[model samples]
Target: MLEEVKNYKLKHKNLKLIPITTKNYWEIGWLELKKEQEEFVGDNFKSMAYAYATVMEGKYAKAFGIYDGDESIGFLLIGHNSYSFEGCPKTLMHSYDLWRIMIDKDYQNIGYGKDAVKLAIDYILTFPDGEEDIITTSYVEGNECAKHIYESFGFKPNGDNYEDEITLVLKVK
Candidate 1:
């Protein structure tokens, strides 16, 4: 644990990950979804317009934003468990599902995402008397970068795909 903490601190020297709240929700939301939509549709104006409106709509699961000083640099969305499916049994489950993760394009390829995920895993593992022995997340089919990062943290695919999402699991035990 000490080593992990040290590594995290080293990686995030000037960065801090904070939970998202109502006050800075707009900034956080725009940073998280805006770039991806623009890249997806190849148009910034429409993407920005849609993201601005949807963000205010407040329809995310659990959301967190990483900040470097006052500027939001990354965001993660964890959806609450809604149903059970094959390979991932519902038995003895007390885990939050990592739904979406987005980092600023400028911060990509650095170690920020890895450190953020480590922070999230550490937070979950510290839960007192929690039945959660695992952390579950998914990556898009063509997102090789994400798959590699999650695998570095010991997450393995569970052979389950819902639409374009491929499920991966990290066991804490």
Candidate 2:
């Protein structure tokens, strides 16, 4: 499920990926966030809805949205989680649990998904001191497209599975 990382261009003529700020919250909420969650995650939509609501409530530190010009094409939320690497002590840090990620259905086949992920990696790698970082994400077993994208970014199984979800991780040195 790995492919060479490439600078893929977005299909939308004037697409731009940007961080979500307070000013754009209501717009994002109305346009992207309020849409029926089932359109994005099938039966898991309820959980996804709750996740978005949590983020909106400030339960997460940061949330980003990928916009096609002024319209939201996709969005992602990242938050801190406690973790330890192979016998290390638990530390308070950021981990990309990828609570939710969605791209407009019309924009699915385009490179926006991959580009959005690259943007995420670039943003996460910017932590000061070049400290090691880890990103964790999960996808339903049959979502081949997503599995490919995550694997292409070097994420591997973490030996944990919840129902049909398989968790994967990438550690950046």
Candidate 3:
């Protein structure tokens, strides 16, 4: 799966990483996160709720939608966060958090989620050096599937947890 994802990102003419904008925000926000997947996602949010909260409240947040041809399959958000947990540190102000990641139920098991994760990490690596090189995210306990996918791409546990989820970090090198 890792090799498949890496290769897909290289020759990805069909997959696209599109910025979530005002006009098309509803498209991804409205996509289903499915009830079974909700336990892993740590919330009942329908992607758009995260979008609205990020847009209207958390000024530091940014959202994106994943597209395969014309179909929106996944949604994710990234932003600076210092208050999402209790032991949050000052260095995190220079860091970014992947606040949410989800693929539509119908889109599961087809590698869309893997491609989306690659896209997000690639996007994070685009910044100039000395400008925050860490990206963090979490998955609720019992979501070993998520942990495996993330770990496949070099994300490691940084000994942190948010609520019931285990925190993981990827350092862009």
On TM-score, the candidate that comes out on top is 3
Clashing pairs in 1: none
Error of 1 at 56 (Å): 16
Candidate-wise lDDT, in order: 0.60, 0.60, 0.69
The numbered model that scores best in lDDT is: 3
lDDT (Cα, 0-100) at 128 in candidate 1: 30
The lDDT ranking, best first, is 3, 2, 1
Misplaced by over 4 Å in model 2 are: 1-15, 30-60, 82-94, 128-132
* TM-scores vs. true structure, each candidate: 0.70, 0.66, 0.79
Candidate 3 lDDT, 3-111, residue by residue in tens? 4334545334587778877777877766776677776763324455655675576346667787888888878876765344456644355677777788888988777
**Backbone clashes in each candidate structure, one number apiece?**
0, 0, 0
Candidate 2 lDDT over 1-173, as tens digits, reads 22333344434556565766667655455433235433334322343355557656655445666787777777665555523345422322346565556676656777877877776666666652234467677777777777898888888887765567777777765
lDDT of 1 by residue, 1-173 (tens): 13333344437666666766667667765563334443321222232343344445552234567776777887765543423445554421345555556777767777887877776666556653344556778777777777887787777787655666677877666
Supply candidate 1's per-residue lDDT for 36. Answer: 48
What value of lDDT does candidate 2 attain over all alpha carbons? 0.60
